[model samples]
Target: MTSKSERLKDEGSRLQVTAAGATAGLISRFVIAPLDVVKIRLQLQTHPLSDPLTHRDLHGGPIYKGTLPTIRHILRSEGLTGLWKGNVPAELLYVCHNAIQFASYRQATVFLHSTLGEGTIPPSAESFIAGAVAGGTATAATYPLDLLRTRFAAQGNDRVYANLREAVLRIGREEGFQGYFRGLGPGLAQIIPFMGVFFAVYETLRPHLTHLELPFSTGGALAGTIASVTAKSATFPLDLVRKRIQVQGPTRNQYVHKNIPEYRGTMSTARAIVQNEGFRGLYRGLTVSLIKAAPASAVTMWTYERALRFYISLGERSVL
Candidate 1:
């Protein structure tokens, strides 16, 4: 019989959680990468698909009007490999991001329980703060990979830098070190609250999820879908802005899209999107994003939970 303590982990030390998270991220990044590429292509397109004038724009059309259409366009235009456009840098980013985020989250949770408990802040509030800290730290640490991934996925027939190494070296040599972090401000803006609510919602639902007695995989999937949809929806605009900013600066000329705008900052980027494309522009790729987010998060959490269980069981045996 599974003991009460075994139903959910007490969370584990920072190192164990980190390893599990890295494993989870590596697996999920591969699974959801095609959807991720489709989403980025849709998000980075400045022209509104709703506009009939979209036909005039270089990369615009009904090409980006929906998720399936965008995928088809990429496949037709850029081939099968296009779907996995940025997988190289993306792998590094996802692995490091999850490792650091989960480790920090575990540490933050412990810190909260020791210092504050449920006395001052609520448990959900503690989760929110911990998630924000974890997301911000991970996003910042692995941001260059993120920027590189975005650039790689954002390109079409025209190439920017031949490979990951060329892109990194060119950005460093040409745009300087700051080039690696072009959109970091908005990235943190998007992630902090996105993850804050992601954890808050997951932790909030977890007790209830346990009560349902679903199998581990099914329950994790349900929880991940709910948390991911809610959080991704709330902060998606900033995500759009971040991708747009990353493609700007010294190398703008090489893109297939001729008229991409350069914005001053986050608000500026957002304002331009809204003013030109209207409110719907802020959520350009939301459908595909939610689609990608669900499986990615579900796989990540399911894998992490299983790994945590294994680690805990191993520890127990070692003690015996």
Candidate 2:
């Protein structure tokens, strides 16, 4: 049985972790918004032509064959603000998503530690399990915002969304309530393994890097970068499928086409991509995605760790 003071302390710690996670997520999303826009554009590119949607001239040869070309084209056509098209929803999603994730992760870790005992399981395994739970919980809570953000980011100037409310109401009216959860199956699937691998790898490598006498932030950043890259590479295909499903609707917005077969579910989406575009289709935006993930993960984890430490210090002082 825990004392009242101990329970209060634990609650304080959890709230602090949640705040740290939200701050980290907001800053990281803002830093990488441009790359995020580019990655979505690349992922939404299903045809091999200079489609107005993706701004890619697949037939224009080598110069247009990569991420840099895509970036240059977005800059030329839409200017700087274009890169942050969905920033509002993106920022909101991150704040809620990551706050829930880190808070749940800590709580889950506590439960697991108590149930399984500290020495009963390896720390890496414990972290992986806790991360999966946290990721799933967070994704379920904020998935609708995620879908809206993806659609907004992938949209061209063809349609104008006055605000987030308009977009939500439109999607609901057009696609039904299910529209909000469009890619939920694949999103949930991707996040579980994605977070499992991320936390496992981060926990495993962080201690080793810290032993090298690196600054705490530097060590956390490096570990996060490596973990994110690895997890993202492994789950890129699932992510692509989730994005595709999220953007499919009745609207003539970018990425949706009547000619293309509508995906019924996760496996169907995978089959469609593979059958139509080959295995490479699943990896379409992989390069830009990796570029975005590395720095975003670094900044997020570094900030999270630092903020968590600061909060913990404050708690300790208060307790004393």
Candidate 3:
């Protein structure tokens, strides 16, 4: 049985971890907001199934070409500010999402370790399961903000949202409450595997890399970047499906044809992409997605780990 002091120390550590996670999330998401904007825009790009010859022209034309071109176009058309569209909601989503996720992950990990005992399962497996649970919980809690962020980012300069309140009101008025959770199914599907692999890889690699004597932040960044790239590459299809589902509503621009029945739900969207555009269609923005995820995740995890270490040090000093 744990002593009272031990329990209090554990609680203190958990609180610190939660705060660190939130700070890391905010800074990282803000730094990569532009990349996130481009990635979402690319994912939301539509190709006409009825016209094979004009598909490239319609979907992959000058405006929605590769990442660099798309960036240039946004700059020329909407200026530097265009890159940071929806940043407010994105920041909110990240801060809340990470706080809940990392805190829950820590709690879950403790519970699992206590129940199963150390070494009963591999650390990597434990981290993976914990991450999945945390990710799902975080997604469920903050999904409304996430939907709004995606919609705002995908909107570009076409629609002006006065503020977060106005965006929420407009979505509520136009799409109803259900609109806030539009792509929840696909989002969870993607997040589970994405975060599972992410934490697993990070936990597995961190110890090995730490032996190299690199700074905590550097090691964290390296492990996080590699983990994020690997996980994102494997789950890019689900992300595309989620983005497509998220942008669907009466007020939003129709990325898919109204005539197509498969674009309506998660499974249907996957089926439609496979039927109309082949398997590759599901990986529409994989390159940009990976590019954005790697750096953003690196920064996020580095900050999280660094902040966690700082808090842990403080806790140790307090205990002393």
Candidate 4:
């Protein structure tokens, strides 16, 4: 049987985990909303979709002119709620995404230690490896739901699918299983670095800051913010490509007009961005991404940590 003191420690840990996880979910919603808006626009090449004549311009022009103008354009034409287009799917996806991410990372870390005889925290490279695998796996598992979310977000209350379930069912029925995994290569490309750097940097910084005796939340938030910004910046190009691929369809014919063959796949997307929008194209939604990711990642890490701590505490009490 567990001792009373041991039970209290475990209970405390469990409470911490629960609190952290919930807060992380809330934070991700707020932070990612704007970035999500921009990413969708750039990925879908909104202007091309909107204009019938210049629709084929996507083959050789900037998908999005710039961030502020895009936001203003969306707001003016679509309304403030337009900024939060497809927010329902976005929020729901985040909830499941974060739930899987936090829970898996925790479990993965333990598995790593046991299998590899590493410490609980693993090395920076190890953290990145584990994070990439976990992030990629989670994204793949949830790719269809994510695809639907991207479609809804891109269409923005256009009466596309009735809801998420309908969206998934419709896609599977209409496009087949492969349709659900559309843009997977680009998505995985983005997630590997996004999750890898996110966890690696956060894990590294958190410990160092803690050693300096700072409060846990303060350190976690700081580390999380930095990690999100860095990770988002590094992976911005892949993000742009993923969005484009996810939204490609007969109905979504914008990216098809270019005469170039290279624009078809992952490498071509990158080349096109460079040729068309220059470096700026790669970071079309970068500002919004930073705005969203900082808070979201910060809250996610903090909340997840708290939730895990709490769950452990409860387990200890049960043992006792």
Candidate 5:
């Protein structure tokens, strides 16, 4: 009977993991979608082409004055649907990414405790390590999909990619296989530190909330906000680089457009953006990212943790 109960508990944990992951994806999207639209527009330098008056030369590449105006511009020109550009790919990537991120973090935390044998609750450092590993592993596995997602997002709100499958084929045919994984290195660089800070701050804050007697959901929201700010602050430069590489000039086969100078690879894109736009250019969307990321992370982590706890509770009752 004890063995059966344990088995039931294990199954419950797995179900909790899955539910938590799904909720994380949903929450992440809801929080990030608008900011995502702005970030991509900033990254793609969309304003320069769309409206002559709003564009300005900042440190280098074209810059927009602020988020509210930019959003207004997109809505005016592209309609309400413009705000959710590339939503399909974004949703797809979020679903897959969160599944791995949340589920693996739970398993990894358990594994770390077992392997270390100290078991007095894993340290914050352990959480950071687990998150970095999870983010890197998951990103590496699904990076090509992420690249496509970025491309779809970065295109102006007025543009469309037909479908993800069509976009993938077009990219491969026009840009070669390596194009599919553009900016992967910078993306990984951004993610490792981002997740490291994310989980580290979150773990640290969770206990503080428990001490304050706050509900778990409230604690989660607080921790996630802190984590998101810290993570995005540390990794914004790499994120800029990732965006640049992911949305480079026209592909080799697209003959209609005049050839902008070609970047040989991700390194070239980084060098070009830096040399041309200066350090500020490397953090093009930094402000908007913070605005978007804080709420997004707050909801994602809060939703994921609560969902996991609820599912686990249900599982336990069923076992009893």
Candidate 6:
């Protein structure tokens, strides 16, 4: 039904979208990587970060405290490289995830607008569904890398599985294939709605904020902050659960978790945290997450849009 030129144009558009997503992920990953390391350590910790006494792991290892102190401890102990632990896997995970997410979202949007929602459903609802599908697809496709990243970040100086290659092989041999998907259920449950709200809020706010002409994209920053914080606040507990679950493999003893409960499922994990550590346990590293993710979200979306515009403009210039 479409001309050759139209088909080519569509392909180019998809490529541009994916490229933009990849660029955004690559750039933003470097921006908040250390903070992400901090988040994971906090998430995997079983005790209150507010405790005055340094909590000890089951192995009597020093459990990390609040963000700054934790950062200091890591630097004092593991050197600067500690902040970027798991960075390789984290980088790959983000690039692949953003590319898939944006590409799938574009396809889903087109499909819904032209086919499913044609003359029927509202655009807002379509955005919600499309965003959900996009996040879920990206998460499922790149889950192994994510699991690896979490595992690497959750550890301190006492490394487990050495590097990425060893981590993959040992996890495969020891825990089996299911080890790769250990936290996938909670991850998906969190990401699906998390991204749904994310895109919905972003789409709603971007137009208004981008046009405000505020210096350094204050509006865009505001929108991104609001979106990330709002969405994360709701799904953050599952994120913690996933981190806990991922480390429950054979190498579980490698890290310090202070007798962390073996969470059977998402709900059980939530219940265990509530019973043991109180409601606040669900939000251990939340401060750093909000600080890191909020700005990273803003930068990512802004960069993605800028990349998209740059690519599209180049395409147009070539055409002209």
Q: Model 1's lDDT to the true fold? A: 0.84
Tell me the whole-model lDDT of each prediction, alpha carbons only.
0.84, 0.81, 0.79, 0.67, 0.70, 0.84
lDDT digits (tens) for residues 32-98 of candidate 2: 9999988887777666333344433343211224788877867776688878989999999999999
Residues 1-320 of candidate 6 have per-residue lDDT tens digits of 77423543454498899999999999999889999999988888776444566744445556776789989988998899989998999999999999999999888877776675453665567768889999999999999999999888877677886889999999999989998999899999999999998888887877787667666666776787788898898889888888888889667767745456677788888898988888999988989999997768978988887888898888889999
Q: List clash counts for every candidate, in order.
A: 0, 0, 0, 27, 0, 0
All candidates: CA RMSD (Å): 3.1, 4.4, 4.0, 5.8, 5.1, 3.4
Tens digits of per-residue lDDT for model 1, 214-253: 5546665678779999999999999999988998987764
Model 4 residue runs over 4 Å out of place are 1-23, 46-68, 119-122, 156-159, 211-217, 254-263, 310-320
Strongest candidate by lDDT: 1
Following a full C-alpha superposition, what root-mean-square deviation does model 2 have from the true structure? 4.4
CA displacement after TM-score superposition, residue 118 of candidate 6 (Å): 4.2
Please identify model 1 stretches exceeding 4 Å from their true place: 1-10, 53-63, 211-217, 315-320
Please give each candidate's TM-score.
0.91, 0.88, 0.87, 0.77, 0.82, 0.91
TM-score of 2: 0.88
Which candidate do you rate higher for TM-score, 2 or 5? 2
Residue 300 lDDT (model 5): 83
Where does model 2 exceed 4 Å of error? Answer: 1-12, 48-64, 211-217, 252-261, 314-320
